[model samples]
Target: MTITQKIKSLPLTFLLLFFTAVNIFGQKPNIVLIISDDHACQAISAYGSRLTQTPNIDRLAKEGAIFNNAYVTNSLCGPSRASILTGTYSNINGFKDNISYNFDFNQPSFVKALQAAGYQTAWIGKMHLGDSIPQGLDYYNILPGQGQYYNPDFIRSGNVQKRYTGYVTNIIEALSNEWLDHRDRQKPFCLIIGHKATHRVWMPDLEDLGSFDDKTFDLPHDFYDDYATRKAAAVQDMTIAKTMRMGHDLKMYDPADSATFEDNIKRMNADQKAKWFAYYAKIKKDLDAKRPEGRALTEWKYQRYLKDYLATAASMDRNIGKTLDYLDKNGLSKNTIVIYMSDQGFYMGEHGWFDKRFMYEESFRTPMVMRYPGVIKPGTAINDFIMNIDLAPTLIEAGKGQAPAPVQGRSFLPLLKNQHYTARDAMYYHYYENGEHSVSPHFGIRTKRYKLIRFYKRVESWELFDLQKDPHELHNIYDEPGSKPVIADLKAKLLKLITAYKDTEAAAIFARAI
Candidate 1:
């Protein structure tokens, strides 16, 4: 029989069920995915932050689900973003590191799937995909590179560059709202708003310059780690004590260097420049008077770094609130699926490090929260193992489309419904960036209780941590007498995963480590 004839002949109860299924499956939800660069989970109050509070970000957790164990396939910026876009690992996507590569926008992505399925897609803010514009996007306005703190330049849809005249975070938020204003209301849309806040050389809005001045941040317990057992950790150069520069990172550039401060204030109009200099003059005066030395100097710089970082984060959180408020006031909250995440985890002075390249907990685990009013229960939290690669599959599933065969990620929709759902036995991570921060290229497997890493290339070494015993990863027990069986099992699993994922290059490298 024809579908129309069958529907007309069906009994009332049967007809209701048939139409209900169609309504439920046919009505795709609008998606708003907000990603910020180098934002550590520990920095968000929703994730139990100790440094600062993020009320707007916390709102997503209160209204939806929070994933506590979300990680990235690779911890660096470009690699992690590539993994998200392609739903595959860095090796599979072909953008393994932060330099000398362009993302092949021709690759099949979840965005393309959504577009094909009749959804309007838009990308705004710091995509960091590559030098060129990404394909499969209907509209986009992105920063040229890492992006500047104040008055950054953005490349719009036609490769036209426009310089915005405000704090980067605020400008990104405003542009997102503008895009939403002009978007077609009839079709379901997928919008990604990427913020450049909380990245390197953190710069706060002028109004937030002294926001954290009264509060003192406590140093991490392992701030003075000697790296006694791990040679890989000992030889790295990301430590804040020695590597964080005063001129570039901490904003203590010489006053006589007219160009340094001028570049920051150039984009500001008269009133804006006046306000900026007024706020900065006080900080410069304090530094000049103190002239802190020795451990005191390092501690002073740490405090300065934390203050600016948290202030920048505060501005980002405010913009998040603005976006959420827009959805609520416009009556788009019920059918829209809102998500807040970071490209990857960042180091927040944990282990006395300020950059993110290692396989440590701070850099490897990212923050993820989602709000889908009817489908997801409010105030829910899940501890399942999830990765950035899983995002593409999840979005595709949410949009009522199937993930393509080439995609390596699995959808976490089941876990959202039932937190105890078994997803994967372990997660894999590989960092291929060589010597940018003096960190060795490495690959590892992280199970529920153990983490095994092989730091190769410049150094052939192994490190194993029993997370149940040492959450801080202070001691590497790779050479401990009783660890032979555990190490053997992890190594076998690692090899199997490497081969299964078609990471042929990594497999060859793993053979040498074994």
Candidate 2:
């Protein structure tokens, strides 16, 4: 071939290379979000937990990145979910708590953004926001309210209610795979798989029942916390000894005696009901024989709680493995981004508590592990402080689209890619519901070394903890000597964050305090 002939073919060669590059780098990636209820980091082995092994959840960290400082704007389930979707705080999003507030679907959401970008979206499992599906999602089959562990009822895409005859965790996993199999193959997709495991009334699958019966858990170091100077922690009702009931929570009561137990038993099929009753009958008999009193009774309750919770979590972990396997078998593993997280952290016998509400480190810091092949390097540990609100923008960016105008969280895509990024020095948290658990309404800021919290509404008091000195937050050194400067700095940062977030009510509280 002559020089002129070679020059004539150069244009076609360049065009071919351009198309290949677009296919390799410019294509949008699929997103898989697996969210669990009340899954504490302390119960997961990936976080160095002594309670249980969570290989499936840990796989995400092994393959991609594990975040050490991931937190939630609000630590309640519904509000955290709302913040994750809208990229805003509870005050801005208007879903402040589980009971009193309804999610405002009018706001911009990440799902809507993904839909606009020609991606199909579906949410299956526990979306406790409402009975009706939110506006942004293309399809859904969500559980109504806090879904049952056995034979749960799911509200489908057209408001059709159907009872699935299986464990809630397994049912959600099956539904997720079903959606994946039937999704529009031409377009990318985002699937949120919500599991109702490790929630209150921890009921494991029939096969998983008594799986942890032999393991004895040591009590948390601060299990007998006297609350000391922490006024808000003292008045609270969330406790393993008092708040957790034998009937409703532990399944150690006769069905006729407890309406919650009766209601739950009625939902299970005959075989499931029989297995559940048989397993608990042994526990009830053992309890009656021992008749544990005083500290013995409390210790028994703690053991039962941990065993049941860890057993329930076992089913969730197995189901997670199934979902990961589905992606692998379908050749979607490479182009798909898989994220495993909880709505918020829960107390696994931390500070003598079973629920999550306070802004302490245990409840405030949620677990988050994200796997994005080729983008996030394997075994990367990110120490940057990121809140749940950041999920919306990060997912939107992954779909190759922009977040909505109202979204507040800046995308953490740069951090995932190991690019130049600015890390947040402090993160803000607020809990609004003073209804359940008697936790006072509070807003606070957590820096790297110090945490400053102010409890208001029912109890107006300030508590400050030097996390470096007291990781468990046992000592409230708000009035300790030599702490004035530190308190002033934290307050300044907290006020700045409140103003930046446009939280007028918090600003008013700050002004009143000053």
Compare the candidates by lDDT and give the number of the best one. 2
> Local error of candidate 1 at 94, Å?
0.3
| lDDT of the structure predicted as candidate 1 | 0.87
TM-score of each: 0.93, 0.95
User: In model 1, which runs have C-alpha deviations exceeding 4 angstroms?
Assistant: 1-26, 258-270, 419-421
Cα RMSD, each candidate: 3.9, 3.1
Best by TM-score: 2
Q: Per-residue alpha-carbon lDDT of model 2 for 1-514, expressed as tens digits?
A: 9977875668887868766656746679999999999999998888999999999999989999999889999999899999988999999998989888888787899999999998999999998996545787889999989888888899988889999898889999999999999999999999999889878888888998899998999999999999998999999999998998988888896545554346567888888877788889899999999999988999899999999999999999999999999999998887899999999999988889999989998899999999998799999998999999999999998898768887888799988887888889999998999879899999999999999998899899999999999999999999988899999999999999999998888888888852
lDDT of 1 by residue, 1-514 (tens): 9988977988999989777667644589899999998999989999999899999999999999899999999898878888888899988899988886788998899899888878999988898878866887899999987888788999989899999888999999899999999999888999999899889878898878889999988988888788988877888998888999876777664445554555654566777766755776678789999888987887887888899899989999999999999999987887889999998888777888888888899999999999987779999997889999999998998888767888999888777766455678899999988878789889999999999999987667999999999999998999999999999999999999998889998888888734
What local distance difference test score does each model get? 0.87, 0.90
Q: Candidate 1 clashing pairs?
A: none
